[model samples]
Target: MTMDKQFHEILSDTRQDFSGWDFSYITRTGRMGSQLLSWSYGSMAIPLIRKAKSMLDMGTGGGEFLSLLSPFPKEAFATEGYLPNVPIARKRLEPLGVKVVQIEDDFNLPFQNRQFDLILNQHESYSPEEVRRIIADDGIFLTQQAGGLDCREINEMMGVPLNEEFAHWNLETAVMELEANGFEISTRKEEFPIQRFYDTASLIYYLQAIPWQIPDFDPEKYADPLYEIHQIIRENGYFDVSQHRFIIQSRPK
Candidate 1:
């Protein structure tokens, strides 16, 4: 097929509707793939969830991961910042006895002081002070974060500047913030794993799923570059980039 036709075709194919935090569309289909991190966030959280008497999953995207931890504590709860994911999460988790709440400002979480003995946040934004306030003195706050420079190669390839707002966010910064909030870090880890996009459409789909990668990415706006990358993919069979990720587990001092 012609380059123009393939580009338009790829655009149409990847523009399909997406929701929540699910990436199975690309990942499951083998379009996009990522190298394994040194640690497994889910595996690590399982034991913590099983032990806690009461736990809160901050920013539960559609309650997908939370749901996996069945037989939750008597007072299990979850909070989601995105509006669309609220209903989806509630529907999936509420039936299982997990209360799902919609949250907005990270600094002002709507919950009683020291309400939870365990708090989990993966790829979600949170405030150290707010987390400190809501967590019990013995509570564990475990989070896996997408570092400021997560998948920055996409930004460079698309000709967009990196997001400066969170450019300094990393494991060290997070540990410091938690320590300042009177928490003692128990474990901290960081990794930069490779992510491969087997096709140009997979790359486009990824950027769509993660809008913050290139804040104003439009297929048309970056058509030339996208096509160029697509050609590179046709020649190289894959496009690789590094993903920055960090995990921190802490508790109140």
Candidate 2:
């Protein structure tokens, strides 16, 4: 009923949902693997942050966004959808003075109305309208979304067919979505041609990570061909892949 009570309830739900998630890979200590989450924070949230009283990071993966937004807020907090991710996030965030909670439901936000002065979302699942509800009246919401062309180009190059669900990405559509939700766009940036280079084995690993390829490809069967592609890449310096993203700076209209 009360906002604090609701936040506690949401926290409980988060713990349960993320209880079984495998986070070992994400929390691993090393410089060997790429820090994709950190990359998101730097590229998406950093430039827009200004001095603010409080900040909120939605879908705060691995708590990297919290770390990036810390300087902007006197106090910062985060909410994640998965329960398992909460502890992992807290383990990394709490010491840094950021509080984290888990969200149980898909659409509802537990915080009291007008709780945050700034909200950051990178690779978030919320639609534009959903985001507007939880933000303070004058708060700014900064989000970076992977563009539709990014997926389309990847799928085309991978020789895989596209699915209907991945159809919601497009620069025009995204801008329209924000405007339709009564958000006035202040800034927009698109970064592209971001390449992830791979050796033969690494190339195979990369391809295997694609979610839509699941239940469709026999990765084991393509083992040799994957390597062959890598050998080609070796001479070529990198396998070409494009990252299309739109960073939106928005405020309620």
Candidate 3:
């Protein structure tokens, strides 16, 4: 097949449906891979979950990760701001006795004050004050954030705009914010792991799924840059970029 035809075919295949925040397609296809962190978020959260009488998982996308941390607390609840994922999360977690709530905004939590003993957030936007309001006096809040500069090399390569919202959202910044919100920081760490994409197709699929990375991304509109990136991948065997991530654990002051 001609290079143009091959590129189009790959792009077409990569643009498949990506629902419920599941990334099995990318992982199963071996199109993309990332290095592991020193500590696993699940492992870090298990102990906290075990100790708490009530727990809340913020932004539980399809309840995938929350479901994995099984044997939930007596009062297990989850909030999902994304409309489509709310039903999916309910379907997956409700059977397990998890209360899946649909949230209209991140700043406002639909719960009584001091309701949860443990709160977990993974790659979710949050309001520190809301977390403070909902958490019990001795409650713990643990979050793992996706750093703003994650995969910025892709934007540079494609000449797309970078997401600068969390550009300064490091461990220090997170700790400061938590402290400012009346939380005493316990643990914090940050890592920049290398992520590798074996083919341009995987990259295209990722950009599509994560539109914020390149807000106005379109395969047809970016065909020229995509072609150039494809050539680079063919020559180099893969494209590699750094993925910034940070984890913080805190409790009310």
Candidate 4:
């Protein structure tokens, strides 16, 4: 598929209906997803990150990476697509002297060419155009994404089988997209057997609201009972799930 078409599909898949969802419940007891993201980036990009003056952390959720990156960077700015996350991120990062910007209205970054030495995306939604257009010639782009096989079990639980074509998420595809955008591959790191515990109901609650899967699914037909089953898993001492994370580091060609 063309990059534009692929990007459209990605955007569609990640749209979540938060009309009645409870945010406080998740944040209070939710699993810290950043632990996985941090582990992936530390393993993939930290060693290659040399001295840099300015850096951008795309989709800097919770600003954990930005906080960690502050010591090594002279100036660090973060962009987040979701506005609800902005306040918390600002609160968490601003105290640490990091600048957090909201990108909800604009996906095309407002920076000039070669303005930054490093750009990082830890599980951010990125298209080839955004990557190609925004990255500075000498800047580095490091991305860590949830692997293709990661969402299968959850999808099965939801009973809405994700279309295979729409589910084409893997290391080879990620490498190809980066290379196609003129990024020379520097490192590809894979994490196998990533295990996490989730109360089945909580998992479904997130699965329903989060965009890890596709969009426009039938929730009433599937979401409720799935949560009930999740309760079973929770009572059984949580469900042990495995996922793979692919971290690719690329530099401008």
Scored by Cα lDDT, where does model 3 land? 0.88
lDDT of each: 0.89, 0.61, 0.88, 0.64
TM-score sort, best first: 1, 3, 2, 4
Give per-residue lDDT, candidate 3, residue 89: 94
Worst 10 residues of 3 by lDDT: 1-10
Best by TM-score: 1
Write candidate 2's Cα lDDT for 49-167 as tens digits. 55567788888866854664455555678888776578888888888777888987646777766787788877666667767777788988887776655634445554666666655
Higher TM-score: candidate 2 or 3?
Answer: 3
Residue pairs that clash (backbone atoms under 3 angstroms), model 1: none
lDDT of 1: 0.89
Error of 1 at 114 (Å): 0.7
Residue-level lDDT for 152 in candidate 1:
84
lDDT of 4 at 119: 80
Better candidate number, 1 or 4, judged by TM-score: 1
lDDT by residue (1-253, candidate 4, tens digit) is 1223432343345434453224445446754132244445664556544466677777877675556654646567788777777887888887766688888544477766667778888777677656667677887888888776775655666666765653677788999987887889988867656444444334544656666474555444454545445455547755555565788888889
